[model samples]
Target: MPQNQPTNKIQNPETSVPKTPEMNERDFLNDMLTTEKYMTGSYNVALNEASNQTLYQDLATIFKETQDCQRNLYNLMFKNGWYAVDQAEQPKVQNAYQQFSGYKNQLPYAVQ
Candidate 1:
């Protein structure tokens, strides 16, 4: 009855209903950063156990690239306010250092 009004619009049953997207860009980037972190950890283990120089160099390169990618993603998320970090206090920092420093004496082999 009014102008610019739809008059009994027909619905198309053949057209499939669109599903909502599972993740936003921030979620996707966070996932990539997390996955890169796991890959970097595995690469560190591989590098430590590798006997061949060639394989070590290859893994090292990949590890470096993965770290770089992770940093970039982190920077992007940080800029977009998708990631948050807490500042460390001097006492907490010194305590962590002192605790880990004590572990040096527990090494299986001689430090020297």
Candidate 2:
């Protein structure tokens, strides 16, 4: 062991954005997952704050986008004729979308 040298140092990789468009199924699915995560986060934060109108609107938009992405993804899968017999988890996704829509509908409206 050298006395003057640094030991066991880990370095983080540089963050570079992807330049090319992703056209594959895996890439599309990853994008959908990312959008869903962001939407859920925005919705939770808006609910937490409870008073930010801008955040509330943003959350609503994100919620719509996430739901649309999910639905379209499934539709594409169905279009490709890939049917799975074990699909107990799909209803839950629909339920979540309905619940989020309900929440959006119930938001307080102030006439200014």
Candidate 3:
């Protein structure tokens, strides 16, 4: 005869400890879907609890700014034909200004 057992640990009346990390079904899933960072396992969802939401938001903003900088750099190089390995060392102040101007004018409201 086969034996039946409780797979999860009963932490308390309020919470159940999952048998495995992968078995956790809440918080991690929320993080993946909503770009919301999780405090614990996938299944452990935060119930609008008090936490540092601003810190995560700031991190997201920083990431976006970094992406924007990279895009601007690529566009600048493209417009000026700055294809050389030592492009930055080469004196092309006028080209830089023109490239920056083009990027500035086109970038706002530009869809990905």
Candidate 4:
């Protein structure tokens, strides 16, 4: 509780589990989340390289579903405090925005 410490962390109470070698709910969910992430990445590659229109559409649908599942798993883990992320500082965010703001002008097409 100091001014120098960051205050933007958002988390829920973490569920307690045994520390033994046995797998727990958190472990299973974490595994599944990792699998989903990998699947989504593979699907993205397939979608990009798809040659047939029909296959591309099908892959796109499956990609969206896989992405959604990944998001849900992430949300569940975050809600259970299994996942933690630091919020970006306002000044740093503004700095990044300012740094990127001029790049839009370099684009070939007009943006709005």
Top candidate (TM-score)? 4
Q: What TM-score does each of the candidates earn?
A: 0.66, 0.37, 0.27, 0.88
lDDT of 2: 0.61
True-structure RMSD, every candidate: 16.3, 16.9, 22.9, 2.5
Clashing pairs in 2: none
Query: How would you encode candidate 1's per-residue C-alpha lDDT over 77-104 as one tens digit per residue?
Result: 7766666665666899999988877887
lDDT of each: 0.79, 0.61, 0.45, 0.91
lDDT of 2 by residue, 1-112 (tens): 7998644432333233355785666456546756766766766766677677887787677777776776676555444433223334667889998898888777798232
For model 3, residues 1-112, the per-residue Cα lDDT tens digits are 2358433332223233366757353333333423422222221322234267785565556655555554555444434433223334235867888798788779877553
Candidate 3: RMSD over Cα atoms?
Answer: 22.9
Number of clashing pairs per prediction, in order: 0, 0, 9, 0
lDDT (C-alpha) at residue 109 in model 2:
80
User: Of the pair 1 and 2, which is ahead by TM-score?
Assistant: 1
Order of the predicted models by TM-score, top scorer first: 4, 1, 2, 3
The lDDT of model 4 is 0.91
Which stretches of candidate 4 lie above 4 Å from their native place?
1-8
